[model samples]
Target: MGLTQFSFGALVRTRWAYALRGSQHESLLNTAYALEAAIDEIVFIFGPILAAFLATSVHPVSQLFVPTLACGIGGAVFFSLKNTVPPVLEPIDVVAAEIPDAQSNAVTGQPAPALQTAGDHAAPTPSPEDNGFRLRRLHRPYSAKPRNVLTYRGILPLLVVFVVFNMSFTAFDVSMTATMKAAGAERFLGLQLAMFAVGSCIGAVIFGSREMKGSHWRHMVMFLTLLTVGYVVFRMVMGNFLILGVMEILTGLCVSPLFATGNLIVKDIVPARSLTEGLSWVTTAGSVGTSFGSTIAGAVLDASSPHMSMMIPWIVTLCAVPLALLGWFLARKRPGRGTGRATNTAA
Candidate 1:
């Protein structure tokens, strides 16, 4: 009925689209998303023209309705054009069902023993450095459960990094709009966003076209540092539209690459069976960050200058860099190639 509900629906729809795209590819998923993100930015290039046209209409919400329709039609065409049918998990893969005792245990409603492979027998050990920190200890419940060990090591760090990254993004977005409006160039907002998208397109193409060697976790920190630099440069040009557009190109290039890289990294790190779920958590973290970012940015802009509000995003971006680096460090000790089914294999 309102913008809130429409936004929530769109969020759900986007996650579904990503998951669908993910299911269709084993390689170059990041590249595909990167190219698509670039093309999507073209919409913003035409945005001012579209907004001008829509402004002449009786209602202002035509802007929202048009994009929503376009998205729906696009999704329909994509699904209809797909050649392959979705795969079914076959009965033979259920080792639990084949084992008579486990089947009986399940039928009696008792918990079945978790199936363990040869590799899973080894336990996660703390590094010498980890022994120095109190927080390094797994919490009470997890520590109490000796049989249940943490499978994915990068998860906690990834979660922390994504939350901060999205928070910074949301804060920057809102603050930029406010700053632009205050400066009497509200119309330039879309252009700046488009320019950013253009930059992202370039990044996506470059990274997507190559064979990325080593762990993706390492590149994530590098990209995040680029993001921080962009934000810092952005602060200098906030009062100047021409310079802002150029800055957007530099900053915008970072977006899709970051997202594509993050997506690929998630795919690499999580088990194949849980890929969609892992990606969904990224979406969830973004949503949570957006909510917080919006509240914080709106409050700051009201009480202080846009320049002051701008600090929120850059600070958050700075925070994400180290967190991502930490995640990178953790990934090494954890050691998963993140190539879906091959994660169990040694690097």
Candidate 2:
């Protein structure tokens, strides 16, 4: 599952870069992200309900096959669309002038031609031989050297913010479940979760349609602070179902926008050559946070009360604000490190 998700994420990022490549890239990317988030939440809203129905009406293990079948069909359709594939961009360092004609022919096991120079001191323009050499180099089977995406400034702190933010969201889920079960209203758990997804879908649509301006760091700080406040409200109203449901929807309003902002940050900081890997790292961080959050929240719920479990998310989210501020400071200190405007030729 991890491998599959990683591949899918990389492909999605590559496609987005290819399709949205112009002056309006930022706005179009935002809309694409919003649509993606909305569709994802819609799937989440239905997937669990369907799984529950299958578990109750059919065999205990039948629910698993639904996702397997869906993935198979979806993968088939997605991969079959050949036109959507992005062009492979080679590094600009391997120019025609760099490799001599003789060495290039030798690498390809072909006979070498006589060398021609413009003059002793004049700069030699690319000849037919040089062009051939460049073509061969472009078509060669050699892979470019791998670059470490984490070495980029501000990326680590941005990822840390995501990790903690996702941990809080996942913990909120466990706390919600604990609260519902303790209240003897476990059947409405699906409804409550669906409300959160619905709210997120709405938020994604609204946020995506707008042309947001200003620093992404400030956007993140604002969203995180708002979400933290929502969680606090969640803890306060856990005992009241109606009020809790309202709070759940309100809190969810920040979820998709926050995720979209994080992806934008990654896109801004990481070089185009490493964009896919950088985005995949964000997905991986979210997965890790989800796993840890659920485990910790479950343990806390078992040992204490739902309110205590809820506190974990509230406090975690509160801590994320300072981390985001730190990221902003670090990014400002380094002028061109993650400016996103400069084109990096190095892979």
Candidate 3:
């Protein structure tokens, strides 16, 4: 059959996969995919050894068949289901307003309501700031909208806590990899990485599905605690390859829900006008934290024994506890923790 004839079937399959697992599963799926990649890397490292052993055997062609079939079948399955599905909105009475006099609306309007912009859509105009505070008088659209008059005094401090916790997390990825290599656990490194990604996928599936939507902060707090425990576990048992991998995986798994729920919290407390800008700052900060983590881990590893280097990452991660606490405190102040109400159009 022609490619066109099979296109609908492909779309149906993609939609089904995405439906059974929400788009959030896309991140979890990536975790599983990274495990598969780790497996591939392992195979690449071992292939030459196998080839040399088989060289003197009776049938060398047998090896070629397995690799070929594996590649072909995997490719066929993935490509057959490579289709993008649009978001299905559950009927929502999204409030819309009429623009009275273009110039009047431009002068007095607030930032336009968050909407999915297409290629033709224009970016919103920049807000005018006065003495560091954006002036509400200059933006008519935002000023006209119904102001949500709710304040949770505790939320600001919590944002700081979340930021600190993230800095610690950023350290883990760099430190763990180098420490494992330094400790002569290099042979099992591939397996360790595989487990890390697989565990994260499991975590994402657990939280991304039904368990997270209602009252997620309680669960989120529990997850953060798990992350702390996981780090401590690593600190206690540095040389044991198996235990290190398990701890890393556990730590990695706890992170996804924290991230997803944190984004939810940011949408709730901040002014609606600053939502996008706030998220961008959060992302940029996390990136910076990771970069610092790499540097810190590298410096520690270079200075002392392999064991000492491994301990530093764990220490840094533990210090980041304040940030997690701050995030939790802020989240507590905000109502509907992870209920998804505040997240509407936030993404």
Q: For each candidate, what TM-score against the reference?
A: 0.69, 0.82, 0.50
Better of 2 and 3 by lDDT: 2
C-alpha lDDT of all candidate models, in order = 0.66, 0.78, 0.52
- The residue pairs that clash in candidate 1, if any, are 196-252, 199-253, 200-252, 200-253, 268-338
Give the range where candidate 3 is weakest over 10 consecutive residues by summed lDDT: 1-10
Q: How many angstroms is residue 128 displaced in model 2 relative to the true structure, after the best TM-score fit?
A: 4.7
After TM-score superposition, the amount by which residue 293's alpha carbon in candidate 3 deviates from its true location, in angstroms, is: 1.0
Query: The CA-based lDDT of model 3 is what?
Result: 0.52
Ranking by TM-score: 2, 1, 3
- Cα lDDT tens digits, model 2, 173-215, are 8998888998899999999878888888888898889867777
The alpha-carbon deviation from the true structure for residue 194 of candidate 1, after best TM-score superposition, in angstroms, is 2.5
- lDDT (tens digit, per residue) of candidate 3 on 208-326: 54433344344445666777777778768766777777777677677666655555455455543444444444454555666666677677777765556555554654555555555
Identify the runs in model 3 with alpha carbons over 4 angstroms from their true place. 1-163, 183-188, 213-218, 271-273, 327-347
